[model samples]
Target: MTDCLFCRIIAGELPSKQRHSSDLVIAIEDIAPQAPLHLLILPREHIGSAADLRDTPAHAALLARMHAVAAELANEAGYGDRGWRLVSNVGVEG
Candidate 1:
């Protein structure tokens, strides 16, 4: 966990262009963004993989938080009333 790059980013040891932050989550622009509006959303904790999500039992709330954040982000980015799409790449590459 100490060596995890994301943990370092969350810890503020490594600089990140954070777009949004909350006590439980953080969102930042993807360094190698494939889309015009690409953001990497992750937990404030060191959740390295999807399996780690199970540890956080309040899954629906987490998703709700993500949706809220995404909507706000989209609006701020001028995605218009239709809003932007939110995708989570499981095992496949985007």
Candidate 2:
């Protein structure tokens, strides 16, 4: 995971405009934004995709936390009334 771009950002090996961070996840502004309030919420630990998540409480909580953070960011960015879309993507193919 050391070679991962998001991991690098999480590890402080690269710079990112972080919006929120916690023990389980991190939220950073998308470098190539598609919306006025675009952001990428990622896990602190590297996982290729949702398929990589374990069917456990910790992993479940991670997903919940990610969504929670996204909602917080969207509302903060004034997208609460307009709503927001959450696209989950990862890796090159993703």
Candidate 3:
């Protein structure tokens, strides 16, 4: 996991334009944003992707928290009323 880009960012080994941070997740501004407000919400835990999460109560709770944090960030960034997109890229092609 030392080679994981996000893990390095979460560990403060890499510099990121961080917007929000909490015990569960951290939101960082996208380096190459496709939209006016593009933020990448990352869990502190080193999960490969959403597909990596098992169907368990703990994973469910973590997913919920991630969504809540996204919503909060969108609202704070003035995109709540206009809405925004949440995306996850999977695999190498993604």
Candidate 4:
């Protein structure tokens, strides 16, 4: 996992436009945003991709926390009322 980009960012070894950070997740602005407000919410611990997170309770908790952080950020950014999209890429196609 030492080679994982997100892991390095969470470890403070890489520079990122960090919006929020906690023991569960780290939310950072997308480097090449496709939208006006694009953020990448990632788990502190690397798990490869969404497919890696079977159906475990811990993974479910992490995902829930990620969504909560995204919603909070969207609200803070003035997109809560208008709404926003949440996208996740999985596997090699991503």
> Which numbered prediction scores highest in lDDT against the true structure?
4
lDDT of all the models against the reference? Answer: 0.81, 0.89, 0.90, 0.93
Kindly indicate the candidate among 1 and 2 with the higher TM-score: 2
Which should have the higher TM-score, number 1 or number 4?
Answer: 4
TM-score of each: 0.79, 0.90, 0.93, 0.94
Residues 1-94 of candidate 2: C-alpha lDDT, one tens digit per residue: 5767888999999999999989999999989999888898999988877768888998999999999999999999899899899987655677
RMSD in angstroms between candidate 2 and the native structure over all alpha carbons: 1.6
Candidate 1 — worst ten consecutive residues by lDDT sum? 48-57
lDDT of 1 at 3: 92
Deviation from native of the Cα of residue 71 in model 4, angstroms: 0.5
Q: What is the lDDT of candidate 3?
A: 0.90
Model 2 TM-score (2 dp): 0.90
Shift in Å, residue 69, candidate 2:
0.2
Pitting candidate 2 against candidate 4, the one with the higher lDDT is 4
Evaluated at residue 14, the lDDT of candidate 1 is: 86
RMSD, model 1, all Cα superposed? 2.4
lDDT of 4: 0.93
Q: Summarize candidate 1's per-residue lDDT along 41-76 as a digit string, tens digits.
A: 877767666655664558767877877888889899
Kindly list the per-residue Cα lDDT of model 4 for residues 43-66, writing each as its tens digit. Answer: 988899898897889999999999
